[model samples]
Target: MASDQPRIDFSGGAVGYRFRRSGERGHPLVRAAGIKRDHMPSIVDATAGLGRDAFLLASAGAMVTLIERSTEVHALLKDALARAAMESPELAEVVGRMTLVHGDARYLLPELKPDVVIVDPMHPPRRNTALVKKEMRQLSSIVGADEDAAELMRIALATARERVVLKWPLRAAPLLEAPKPSHQYAGKTVRYEVFVTALKPHVK
Candidate 1:
């Protein structure tokens, strides 16, 4: 059943266009990730759905570990990364910074001490289904919503050395109430809530 799912491709087509366009400094996701050319943070993407956010961080120079729990989604992501790596020198370099791990981040985060942990759990189903992308719809049909996202945030808070960033719909309530974010970056459709740990000394 999983094999019947569509393969993820980033090398060309609409996804490719978004990939290239996202590399710019002005892209909302990039800015929300707090990426900078001079000081890229080592990041752990706890909910690496399609690897878009992780790839953006790597393209900006951060060493990124992408943790995907779904076997089907992980396979697609792996295949996509392998293809992108062989497509061009620049792409290869970006792919080099990304590491894919198949497992639950809640279990893995304790062992990883990244500068930042990013959590972009699935959003609640939209009333207008057409507003959601086809690829995302497919993903939702397979993996379902991450209902325990609040618990994931708790684990991330304990694991991250510097900060934990949670991506959510612009108008949706946060995953949890306590441990409020130090600040947030808002875009038209999404918002990044940043919880500062301020733990041991680490690169921003």
Candidate 2:
């Protein structure tokens, strides 16, 4: 059955399943975001799609600011966060760490100086469409590809204090060439490209 309400339910459904199945400490997303026990970097998720990665970062104790340009997706994320906050004490704590922003990140990034800026722009549709999840398919159909992803990345790189992380398909080319040497953390189907901006002296 299709859910009428957008939910970030960590207790049940696909989100819950993923939460239980993935080891939080060793998850690739956490590793890629440079999450540590002592130092959890403030992250700006520029393309906060389903709020999955932002939620993960929040759960790991990082303060996350999610920016969603699309009104529909932003509403979904907002509803999900609200529901999750009401449902469980643990989830409420995580929700508290997340700040939702409705606007294009390009316009907002200048004012917010976060330690890490994470960009997970929408990928182009695959040839085998059946492999994609239904919700993702719907989102892609509604939002289309992020043609301005490179511009967003440029802004992120300029604004981020420590680094700018980009999540892309395992085989896809990067949106922009790195100014400095970058690192890669590969998952089964996706990979995170880490560009160390080090714009601030205290970044290390």
Candidate 3:
């Protein structure tokens, strides 16, 4: 478990915390999903990690469910959520809309049918930008890489009703080789691949 990950708070609330890449703003893939403020889906971030991407999704208007397997990570995530709730009352309202489950996303995701499921398997950082955010660096040193990334991807694709999105390096291959993405969003180092699972039939 990532026991050494740094945790911070503001006024007895989870205001700001540190992650491997603390200074980074958001997940490139998640941002690329093109989620509209009003068309928010119920999202489950299977690999919650330090909850950075999950937090970003929530901030984007999706009701997020974060599933974490590491006990240490689970604890820190709760603390951060609580602190975030306390610091920003508005965030607290958002927290009310979110849920954190301290368990494997594989087991939990099946029971919760979200409109969209997001997974970001931990991959080894390229030697070039291996230098991650301080908080992420610490946590990564402890949590290591996700051994079941492929499996998680499979599960997410099956579980999501509308779509399953995978966040990967811009140069990496698709998580699953089935149904090529109907759309994609590219960033400097990463991108979001949107695989549309079902389509509404045309109305007569």
Q: How many residue pairs clash (N, CA or C atoms closer than 3 angstroms) in each of the candidate models, in the order given?
A: 0, 0, 10
Off by over 4 Å in 1: 1-7, 18-22, 127-131, 200-204
Worst 10 residues of 2 by lDDT: 1-10
Q: What are the clashing pairs of model 2? A: none
**Ten residues in a row with the worst lDDT in model 1?**
125-134
Model 3: CA > 4 A from native? 1-3, 6-31, 127-133, 199-204
Write out the backbone clash pairs for model 1: none
What TM-score against the true fold does each predicted structure earn? 0.88, 0.88, 0.79
Which tens-of-lDDT digit does each residue in 121-160 have in candidate 3?
7755544443355665676766777888888877877778
Give the alpha carbon lDDT tens digit for every residue of 129-198 in model 1.
Answer: 4524666788887789898899999999998877899998888887788989888988777888998886
Worst 10 residues of 3 by lDDT: 11-20
Per-candidate local distance difference test:
0.83, 0.81, 0.70
Model 2 TM-score relative to the real fold: 0.88
Model 2 Cα shift for residue 117 (angstroms): 0.6
